[model samples]
Target: MELYKAAMVLGGVGDALGYRNSRWERCPSGVAILSELKALGGLEGITVSADEWPVSDNTVMHIVTAETLVSDIWSLTDLYREMVKAYVEIVEQIHKRQPDPATIEGCSQLKPDNYLLGWHTPFNKKGSGFGAATKAMCVGMRYWQPEKLDNLVEVSIECGRMTHNHPTGFLGSLCTALFASYAVQRKPVVEWGREMLKVLNAAETYCRKTIRHMAEYQESWFYFETKWQSYLEERGIAQEGQNTPKFPKIYNAEERDQVYREWSSEGVGGRRGHDAPMIAYDALLSVDNNWTELCNHAMFHGGLGGATGSIAGCLYGLLFGMVDVPKGLYLNLEFREKLEELAAKLHKAANEGEAV
Candidate 1:
């Protein structure tokens, strides 16, 4: 019954704040799309709801990760740190011209994998459910046992508990981190996308049963008949005790399936939301593609997965090497400055783990 304009807030703030430093060099087309998103937020339309504007799970999730990195203690409950980052986002642009930021926006100190700070699952709240990045914070904090860590799935499961307490949400996180960890690593080492496919397929294999529940995922015909229709039908079909459907060992055997697999709880590309790996996948594939468009799709399609979508979007956009994202949006995405500082801390933590 309520019309939500939070998406517009995210788009507007991202554009306005980012226009200065880290924002992507404006492309005529990208600027146009930015305006479109801005207009959608009630700037032009006679809005029915004003306070209803929510930056959504996308921005909040990013807030958490950005906050976590800057905290004195790497704890998820550190809300104070998060608030600090929210207030001081311009720091991301501090060293932009000096010594050339090793990564995006003078973000030389942070590591790629450690970017995600925390997560939040919907738990049937009818909103973005916790996805991958947040749970990793929760699980990773405990499993500091680097030696025993078997694979990405184990890490994801332990971390997923921070928010997405549900098995379905856990599955999404498992796939996202496993693949992001893999695809990101493969990029500079080997340009070929095939090398990273193993991790993606591996993740899909682990979430096979849940994947089967989605109308499009259970069979090829559903996907062929209608794209988004099947998306709606498969949502929330499984109850607490009904037993979720089984998943598949491979990609959906349908259109452009190989290029991008299912990414959401549906266990397919249509999974909606973000996957850091998917962004890298597309970036590696399309040079002419607009980073803003890719980020928009990842951010907008992601609420079902919540914070995972936001972190995943950042990971993917970041992987494009900073120059990829629109200058206006990246500069003002609520916590860009703290993100760099946080990235440094995360990088230090990661390196400390490696040294030990």
Candidate 2:
């Protein structure tokens, strides 16, 4: 079965691999053409384009997340501080590299233009503002520090609002961060997945379905949010029957599904778009007690969508122990072993009831 732990690594792999094939330009008709090549056969038969899917901030953001996980000593305060540090570093680079009088005209979040053209970028707007990482770390820290959960959740969003004002962007980031917090505390991912959906449903109830998370997968620029039918299939979450969306379960698909659907029916329609619970449910559904498959499936999903994919990956990491992860994937990673070792240390610390 796909454990939440393995999903962390697998999600990245899948996101990268899927992006490679589906890259932004590649479509159902054919792959994208980066550059025109001369036709060997008739001009009509010539191959004009190929495929190259490059992940955007979604992939890059995870670098920050992973860094936060490995290097911060698992301290919530340290994690939040470092997360902001990373975001600042990236934004500073963007600011430095930004074309003067940057005419970033669109409302596109996926661009340097957003940083250049957008008014009062987060770096300048908020005092001590971080991204969703703060919330995740903060809120997750809550389980261990229940009295502070509300404060952390609120403050985390305040920080996110410094840059991301949009409901989807802020809430999505917030939710993801909270989930991460849970993982850091070694919470069972399946339970975490269940809780995430519950939060969305509760938020949706009063919001009147005006908002929803559209966890999109991009193959390239311009073309956003690819269809995840096939990718879901490969990971085995494509088959939707049991109420997994509303009622996710690690051991029981039917119970998970039933609970998921029950909660979802009462949820906001718009808020259900990129239903993270779906990915969480998929992680639970894809499991076979193997634990490794969780990360594998999440990485597979990451091929479809990055943030959600990583969440799925992290969940797998949270649920099943990291030892179940494959030797090669961990060994071959860019400091893969380091991530594993850090996680192990954190896990030991958490189990030993030590707070960083």
Candidate 3:
């Protein structure tokens, strides 16, 4: 129960800190971000409050997903319906959250019953953003039963496709949820990404069977799978800690851009679905037991700091809970109490085999 609370609450804390009222989120330079942190007395001096460090759209959409999951939904249709309704409400608050373009477009095209008819937002090359994955931690929490891996993939991919139809987009959704489920099962963090690749085979088969008619579906999965495999290889090499190259504690803008470019769709770094989660995973794996350093690497990168920090925080919180999180990091976080309530409910629902 406490672990769930940590995941949700720290996710907000990460968003707030990395967002820094949206000042650092788009800065694209880890060096500059570190310098600014030093000026503010570094991480310890920070407080996560709305007026100071408000959670970004990442946490906002995550809340929407969490609320929908805890509703009394009897079937997938009901789940998707509730999601559409919630998204419609969120769209009205655009002036506040600054949602991604794909989200806005997808919500605009949604019909209350469209999902029931097996319809989703059409594929757009540019629609493969990280928004889908960033908001899916609850999807992982909701269907966390390890034996329900297929169910997790089905719902997660469909949820991703509601706004982002590309393989990178939906696959990232599956990856995030899968990792959360593994965390609930107490799986080793080092093996999570590789395990995800094994599951990707099943997910790819499912996608091929369901969306074969879509253009280039096979190529899409191939691209997504290859990228993940490559990342896993890099992680494995790093784990050996032999005479191989090492990643820096804080990357300069150029080095950060290069790393993200390799993972990006075009060159947008953390905005892409795949790279966003990859960045979070990289941050988690690079650290031994340094939570602050993990967060520093997670948030100071040249990518979408809020998205990566939120993902990293969710992963860490799930595995370690709030016990090891810095004291007072979330004391002033906006909606902290509400997030903890939702997390408790979500955790209870997961254990009870029904939404409560």
- Best by the lDDT measure: 3
lDDT of 3: 0.77
Model 1: per-residue lDDT, tens digit, 1-356? 00001221232233232221222222223234345456755222312121222233334343353344335653433432342343234334323321111112112222223345322212321112333333233122222233423444544542332333333344445544443444234333122223323334444454453342234233332221132223223332123332232223331212223223444434433232233334333332332235444444332221221232333443343244444444434333444444454444544454363321
Q: lDDT (CA) for every model shown?
A: 0.33, 0.36, 0.77
Q: Which stretches of candidate 2 lie over 4 Å from their true place?
A: 1-60, 63-84, 91-148, 155-163, 181-194, 197-273, 285-297, 301-303, 337-356
> Considering every candidate listed, which one attains the maximal TM-score?
3
lDDT at residue 237 of model 2 (Cα atoms): 34
> Superposing all C-alpha atoms, what RMSD in Å does each candidate have to the true structure?
15.3, 12.4, 3.0
Q: In candidate 1, how many Å is residue 201 off?
A: 11
Candidate with more favorable, higher lDDT: 1 or 3:
3
Cα error, residue 328 of model 3, in Å, equals: 3.8
User: In model 1, which regions exceed 4 Å deviation?
Assistant: 1-35, 38-55, 62-152, 187-289, 300-312, 354-356
Tens-digit lDDT track for model 3 on 1-356?
A: 98899999988888787778878876877778888889987778776678988888888888888898888888877888888888877876754655667777767766775555433566766567888888888888888887777778888887787777778778888888988888888876677777788888788777777754356555566777777778777655423332232565656555766787678777656787788888888777777446787777777766688888888888888888875565667988888988999999888888886532
Candidate 2 local Cα displacement, residue 16, angstroms:
4.2
- Cα lDDT tens digits for candidate 2, 257-309: 33333323222111122344244445555563454344333322211233334
- In candidate 1 the C-alpha lDDT for residue 149 amounts to 33
Task: Give candidate 3 regions above 4 Å deviation.
Answer: 113-115, 209-213, 237-257
